[model samples]
Target: MNDAHHRDADAPLRMTDAQHREMRNAQHRETQRAVSGFRGDIEGLRGLAVLLVLVFHAGVPAVSGGFVGVDVFFVISGFLITGLIVREVRTTGRLSLARFYARRARRLLPAAAVVLAAVAALTVAALPPIRWSGVAGDLAASALYAVNWRLADQAVDYMASEQASSPVQHFWSLAVEEQFYLVWPLVLLALVWWHRRTGWSLDRTLLAGLAIVALPSLVWSVSLTQVEPGRAYFVSTTRAWELAIGAALAIGAVRLSRLPRAAMVWAGWLGVFAIVVAALAYGSSTLFPGYAALLPTVGAALVIMAGLAGRGRNAAGTGGAAGYGRGVGRFLSVAPMRAVGALSYSLYLWHWPLLVAAEAAWGALSVVEGILVVSLSFVPAWLTYRLVESPVRRSGRLVAVPRRALLMGAACTAAGVAGAVVVHAAVPPPPQVTASAGSRPATQALAETSKRPTAKPPPQDEPTSITLDPLKAREDKGPIYRPQCHQDQPSAELQFCAYGDLGSDKVMVLAGDSHAAQWQPALAAIATRHGWRLETYTKSACGFFDVEVGVGEPAVPYPACTAWNAKLLQRLTGPDRPDLVVTSSDTNYQVVRGGSILDPQASRPAYVSGLRRSWQAVRAAGVPLVVIRNTPRVNIDVPDCLSAHPRDLAACAVPRERAMAMSTDDQIRAAEGLAGVDLVDLTDDVCPAPRCAPVIGTMIVWRDAHHITATYARSLAPRLDRAMAQAIGGRTSSTAE
Candidate 1:
């Protein structure tokens, strides 16, 4: 009936029945070993991948590009999983989707659930109340294997970008793998079904399918990485090609198995070299999962292929390179490597949350401290591996029944989701603040002509009760925070919003970057009281200067910002120009010139020239310009500090000299001799000489490190109105009753 019986049917007639039965059993065992035997070399490769990632995350200076290790892991997973599927389909002529999923569930879900539950508890203890709801949401998404999409959406969100990293953010990689597992099998099954119906070669059909799915993803990855690198990093579509390379290797493994031992050994070491080189050469500035990802992914494929070739030689009794313990494989199959590989999955899960918790407790950890925190995670990792992962994966009952394993996986997921829901429910709502009408103290309202003011006596101790809830501070961004009012990257088209006294004949325009946008509440209130129509034109990280600006870490040329500035200047100088154009921008933008980004000190002169050029354009058009000096930055997240230290508010205050130094006031220098451009200095009103209080007159001054809260900005309306009136030659308009 089978190969073993068929081969011995005629030749073994002389042998006894018992001896014939024993020979068949021995051959069957050998066949099973060929299909599913363990590879110690692969285990060692896993150890190497995890070690690279951990060391990089722990701030090891040598492995700047160590993040490439994730690409290696992707390749390894694709090869092993694809090989298993191919062997099953080749042996049985049909794939059992249920059994495949059951095996995956038994191997992954138990460990993941334990880590999620532990992170949820850690969130309650270490993270501030402001972060609890978000972490709970992240936990639920991780359980559903959809956190990657959630993070992808957050990548483009302006406000979300500033929030603290979630402890469970590492789950994004696991989500991508699980999503692949869900779809890859169905695709293979469809190809198998077609093969059965048409008598087509299954291998060729599978290769064609893989090519169709993977090539476009590779092209898209390259294109998207250039335009939207943040979103590109987290999305599944951009990363699929890396896994496909490994799957392609699996499909060709049989043909490649006969390669010479010397060739295999060379390839094995070369692959290791490539992986190590990428780890050392790459850094946070590297654009990832694009063409750059090929180095590590192909390197991993080579290592796996070489290991397979060695095993093939051993099975054939050629004795040249009998096993993985040859060349690089020997190094990989050593005991230390195998042990780390065995615990790699649990270690990966446990390390990230501990690192995040440590950073949250103490501002930022040194390299040694980070390494110590990661090292401490081994205890929980080992416990989870021993108590949960091993027992469930080896459970005889679950293995005997696929349905029971699937049920257990479902139960584990539900428990994780349920725990997240409880944490979400337990988080208290943000406290409410009651607003009251009040007048500003005379000394606090510094005018445009005022001299440099002396340090004021320390304000009475921080109010017992804050007027705005610290939890609600982040959402206190002004009316112009919407997409229609403030444009993001990738769009060069001009977009503006009109508010306050829309029917008034007098016109005023507010224009610049987010620092300019933050003043909208006060300016809008002033416009409403004085009966002037106000139009706002602002873009995130894009200033209203005639300078080539570079943005983001390891800054790249911002062409969109250039285009937006051109369009905005054209509108301001056109026939429908407003009577007054008020502008402000963050002073920290790097200048791009001759294809290079200049350092901060080098960028100052370019900024001054650019500001003068913009101001000259408005003046030539017969429109007056008002430049609000950029506000002082706290250089620390005010809301997070407030939430962490509510009672001892002094701990959140930034020193006066340090805070004021953040405002370089290049605008002041540009406007020195420029006619009809009024410069309004509001630094004294925001920060007195001695120190800048986090809470001023019961109002939270800053919503984040830089942007002022809309509530505080609104309270400054009366002072801003007085300053603007004096700057614009005291135009007459009735104030609102």
Candidate 2:
């Protein structure tokens, strides 16, 4: 163990036990050869990779492929860590798991904890109460090095994906790296033990074992990227192969040392070109960490291998290429590249949160804003690298005592958790306001509301001060939510629930996305009054339009949504068709026609055409359809906006024109002239004129940017009920009353 620390790069192994000396000595020399062959160019690669990721995240154009930098990082980590483990095992004759993990913790935790604490403080100062829960959750996950899985779950979740990015979202890559650090040592230890017991070549044994691990992981990655790309992007199972690629190179370092100088030079430059091209050309449309990842990972491997070949002992054969080494290594070892590389880890951690905070405080970061934010991150990154990461990592006392290192890690984790708790506690809860029946009469509310009024409407006076709570607004979902009858975006199965009088013969079926689900409270109120059986079939982000939907930024086809729609349409037009099929959707999609995508404006015609098709199916089933126009979509999360700027509720109000522009105007136009389709627009009740206020009738108007609060939705029951009655021509029992 002592020899493991003090041995020179070219030193031969010192053996104590005579029986194992030859085997151990040979192994040690091989490790020394690999370590002695280190090059500064690798650190330059780190600088380049980190810069690409930082700029890409900062929204730099033409760097859409910058995300591939993470693949480069995975390869680097695998190579360095694998080399260290092999060296230690060769010298000490045993793997010290405790020392390995403790070293990793010491190297990574202190700076991370400081950054997490800072982010927490910043979040409390700038972000709204509604965002605290998510940020807190991310902080905890980051502390535990499980943020990758947490983010994977969130990526597939409809509500979570819509949320603003958390300051610590960048921790997911670190989490993946940390998880590998934990498991890889154990695997290496096992392989060493097997090699000794079976008398097999160490490199050959490791190569076979890693191949077993990497191949299956690569297969899973390829398939999942096609199936659930969002989750696959973060999950460790899909990313294990990239790390394996680097480990394989480390095992073959002995052979890599023999490449010619010219070959090394060409390969090194080609590797840099591959990474640069990937960063410049790739965009959000690319399915990554799959086959596409090979370009960057292979490029990174080539660079590392070339660097190794240039430094090996043989000027001709045993390994040595000073001219090739000087060409790449000298350039990379320059002051600026070396300095950026030294601060890369801390910079990667700090840059993302600052960008997120900047965006959250204002709106999207302009190119100039992004540039300034990236520049400012260097200050903290340098400070953290010097003040926190350096001192603790180099401390001999902590390095010698594995237990002490672990204790320090525990302390850092505790600090991160405490920071998260403090941030979470700062968020104010929703105000408790009991609805008073006499405050606003159900009958007179509609009479006072004018149709198509152009002036800014007054807020409802049901209980003005306690209109909505930011915390509760998120939880204030409809009846269909509790039982999960309203399926999430990823679910393909059709789920149905009866909310009203189940025994009643007069059935009303409600269907669409969460926007349609939001109206359930109001519809249920009407259903109970008239003893009508209300059947709800809703899916998140799955609108009723008979068109393909996209999931993320580049708009990948949502297979689950397509499957759900097919199943739902079959059920809706089957023998159990209701007396009236009521549908509403927050239409947020670009139209897909004959495999070509049309933008939001051009897609209106296609949206209307899809609606006509649905109307025809329902009409053919001998059922009347009442289409509820979707409510206004505010530009910001009303609850969050109100919470952040509580003293100025007026600031939370969006102009009615802007809000209406976000509505399903295309779908409404499509419904025109269709037989058996009755359009019931209640936009006036929800928005009521020139502007849409955050609060109505002492109830919060919106839960998020798009969905309305259940309390507010219930408040609109009287108006919605009236519209349904008029649209159905008083067909139900309660209409005449």
Candidate 3:
């Protein structure tokens, strides 16, 4: 029965049952060692990270720096995963890719799948239908470990920026880690193969390979953070260096473990200080994962390195596998830290959804309420850790059999996808309401409604909540959007999209930012009805001002807008000039001068000067100009807020004074002395005297916070047409025909 003896029949081969049992026992011990040589210190680090993130989410101002805990986590993950791979390669002389991946599957996928499913189901029930589709897509991406890239794509997307946060947004980090897990092993396998063929030591080879990968990634991180900080925050390339720092430590683990006790103690304490300080000093404006990230990542690296110093039998003259009882290692090995660390994964998974759900249900939370929600997160975290994470992770049968583990992982993935599909299917679409037969003419309706005694419109006059039709409300964009006529800030070329009678000589040009674009529906209606040509030239985030302004995150100078405006000015004054030119802008951006940002107070005069210059040029060309005041800004998303407060739709209205305060009053002053420019104020039409209501005469007034919905815009056609005819001083020769 002894295959070794049978193969070499010439040798007298005899083995006792005791020898066989001993050999089998040794293998079993090695497997157990590989799977369960628990690192209490590492668990404590995990505990620290989760605690930081949880407190930060709890809205504790002191822990503003707590977001850096994610960077710390990247370091810890890299160190531990690389250490395991190095150990296996050193002992077995080759890597077991199947077993390594199977272990990762059991440890990460099961609990993650549970959270994804729960998020999808809860999102459908609790959140607005507007967010459901996004949440569903995020769920599928999270399940497949690709949400980070998806989020990165969305981050720079101007339209999606206004969307509310997804419940599973935290999974972006997990996706990055999962991506590393998939790629790192193959890299390690190649290193091990090269070690077998060539004479290079495995540790040196790994260190060199990690350096090769980490250095360029670090360079890319710094470069991208400078230009596109928003997208850089979520992308994996920006975070790879953080992981590589830990991998490098794992490669030199034995060498690092031999440092002096005193040195380790200082390093550990200093690292903890660095981490806390970085968290405190940093804020939303801090360009992350760039040089700024070095503070936390290096701090985490020090803490991890210091924790290993003079420990684990790797120290010179140390005997056995006993670890040293000195430095931060002793501090981190404490039971409380280990206990929390044990549940860290589940805690992290549960906390974000709870916070998002709390915010969705009850606007912003008080400090005390936030603390309570974070504390309540512990309950589910404990349950998941004990019932799901611990049981499956500890089962030897699961770890010992790669096939079963993979199948289990596959099943969990399938369940997550199925849950998302079911949630999407279960949620019904918004009801479509036809135009009411009793709908009044927009101008006459406003005139009659203004005569009513009370500021609040009566229930009979109130519009049904078109906000409930969330999808329709979001799609209620102007005609310029569908034709891609709205130019973004990056483009200088003029995009001319005409609406209504293009053959008519009575031409009306609409130009400005998205605020101006919102009027296209009404402009088109008037142009078509009166046989006038309506031309549109609008851009997102860019206004009509000729002055330089800082916009977007980090307040970058908008040179494109300046360039586009100059070209527009020239075209408007040329022989091809329209009979009438209309313009409006958000006017929210700060003016940029000599690379310095000027506040609104200082910038208003500059903005006025810019407006005065542009208007003068247009008037010189014999073209009359109409300047419509920017629309009132209701700081909250009207649709989402109305959806939440369905019964009392009036709850979504803002006081007229407060709503009107958002527009720059300086714009009115800028137009006062200008010749041949007529000013039309329709804000009272949209948001009457005392309050700016979300719904005005059966049409939603605003989409998101600032721009008026197309429905509302279209309803204003009759009033706008009258105003346009006056501004142009009667119809032109083309409209006379």
Candidate 4:
């Protein structure tokens, strides 16, 4: 392996055989040609794709679908790889599928393994202990190019935020491409052999591929987009058609030479515009690849088509319309774009996490700020390209002695797998057991009876029952219970949320996800206030999606949540409905809705359709739905803010305008329409005046980048008091009845 591939301290050089293998693997590395037709333009297009992805990710309002740059890259890869393999088949008569894949493994496995190892280490250090377990599992899945399945399993949780923002998220695209590389080559080889053996020429062989393989893939792409947009967006099987589109272009390049230079320019420009526009306009709502995705995919196809070929005579081979396509071809041929294209693999690998890390290191970077960080991220990419990517890729050592590179590649892959094992071993989750036939935990749980407890609301003596009436006179007993009772805070304000002295008369129901669990302290205060008890029915990601109360975690239903919900549902219908369902999830849960961010819609229809089913389950259980419209979903990450600003509250506050921007008045108003449901007025409660602070009354209310900190939920007692008291109905009068 060239001097660059030598193992560094982070990557220990163990076996000499492995090192020799690493060096030798370089020969099989298939190098992409420097802009074959209009090299400059393709480089420009690659830059355009990368830029679109960058701006889109940086919260640029315009480039919503810019992320599809990855798909664009996929298509480009397909075209390029197809051309290479077909050329080999034509020249050599027999295509070596093993050699093609080995080259791919050599090219991809090293950098990917290195990056995966880094991400794994960072994940273990940064992610919560509980999260490391899955992070570990994901690591292993990613190594095998099956991470898409892991993500799909997690996505079943309607409330799961696309925490795919994990350092490893980019790996999904790699996985898709890797999977495609594995199968497409063999399929082509088989076809090429059959046709050539029968004396067919290259043109006819390619046409057959276009007719049989590429065409079917394109058709499936459209169909998959409709039925399973999310899967279609991420899954390789669904995305293969896009690559095939490019592959077809490569196969037919010779035929496209007749196009005018002017037309080529227009087509190429239009392709750029399409990708740019799609990136800028697509947002959390676009159904993706369904029909909407056609914009960028076709735009990319046009670029490939523009470069397809040109008759070099009058227009050369660029055709009559080759104006700037040739010029674009020339411009992209410039040194910078080509260099970037040369190192595009490394640049793509390192850019995201580096930018993300920068964003994390110092709050969200502005447009200019993001640009600077992106510029800086290239340093590492350049260094790696110069040090690792270049030498190893060009080296013929691997071709001379195949075992060295093979073993080295295996070791690199093993490191990733081993890291995955470490994450798993360090923090193991419950043992995995397959779910019963075809029944998803969410689906089965959603279908189960809605449990409304018949138990009376927790006794009035409970602190969760104390009333807070802004309109009422002040009582010196200070609302009966103290906020921050969970921990010592000499000055922390105290307020009551639950009331009534219960001798098995009332039940204090805690609902929602981990946000609800954080209030164990506050809930305990109320339970302690009354001669009552505390019960647990917690689900980690069950964000009150009534039907799928607990989902996507274990194949087995969350028996605990169901058991408690049943009891709670009985009480509500019979006489017990939660004096208060102290739920804390934002009604607007976010999801990766097909390469775009999607927030829950608040319109009556959106709400009714999205939530009524769950609400019905709740109401049917005979309990009043004490709906807690989610706490302010702060775009300003809380932990990040804390680390950035310790004592100065000003730094931690989300600016007034921005805070107002996130508030969903429509959602709250809709919840208010439910007379039986007590809407906890949080819009006003969470934000006092100038702004909503990430930490209020010294309680770090906002948690992580998205959720509220558990410590912060304890401080909401005062805000919850009046509404909770009404729900509990005056049971919280004494500490001991």
Q: Could you give candidate 3's per-residue lDDT for residues 1-737 as a string of tens digits?
A: 58976767744333556577568646533442433245666777888888998988888888877889999999999999998887777667678888898899999989998888889867876786667777888888888889999998887776677778889999999999999999999998887777767878767788878888999999999988765677888999999999999999888876676678688888977887888899888876577778989998998898887766755443222211134355565676677888888889999999999888888988888878888998999998999988999899888899889989989999988887877787667666664434456755343344454534333333222344342564667678976886569886568788879989989988889988888899999889888988889999888777777788875565556777888888888778887888789888887878888977687789888888887788888888888888888888888887777666554556777766788898867678878888888887787777774666776656667788888899878877777777767766765322321
Write the candidate numbers in order of decreasing lDDT: 1, 2, 3, 4
- Mark the regions of model 2 whose C-alpha exceeds 4 Å error after superposition: 1-31, 34-38, 314-330, 430-457, 460-464, 591-604, 733-737
**Per-model tally of clashing residue pairs:** 1, 4, 1, 94
Model 1 poorest ten-residue lDDT run: 441-450
Name the regions of candidate 4 deviating beyond 4 angstroms.
1-40, 58-65, 117-143, 152-164, 193-231, 258-266, 311-327, 401-403, 418-737
After superposing all C-alphas onto the true structure, candidate 4 shows an RMSD in angstroms of 17.2
Q: Model-by-model lDDT, in order?
A: 0.81, 0.79, 0.78, 0.56
Tens-digit per-residue lDDT, 1-737, candidate 2:
66766675224333435537576667557546645454566777788889999889878897988999999999999988887787777667888889988999899999999999999998988787778988998998998889999999988877667677889989999999999998999899889889989988888889888998999999999888775788999999999999998898877776687678678877878888898899998887787767888899999998888776634464322221333454454455555776787789999999998998898787778988998999999999999999999999999999989999999999999999999898888777664444464555321243255465423234542334454567777678877787559898668998889977989998988989888999999898889888889989899778776777666655666778778888888888898778888899877677766665577777777677777887788888998988888888886867667767665556677777888888758667878788778888878778774567776545677888888888888877777787777878886543321
Task: Give the poorly placed runs of model 1, Cα more than 4 Å off.
Answer: 1-36, 197-199, 316-322, 430-463, 593-604, 731-737
TM-score of each: 0.89, 0.89, 0.86, 0.63
**Which lDDT tens digits does candidate 1 get at residues 60-105?**
9999988887888898888888878887887676788889999999
Pairs with steric clashes in candidate 1: 65-282
lDDT of 2 at 213: 91
Weakest 10 consecutive residues of candidate 3 by summed lDDT: 313-322
lDDT of 1 at 557: 78
Clashing pairs in 3: 65-279
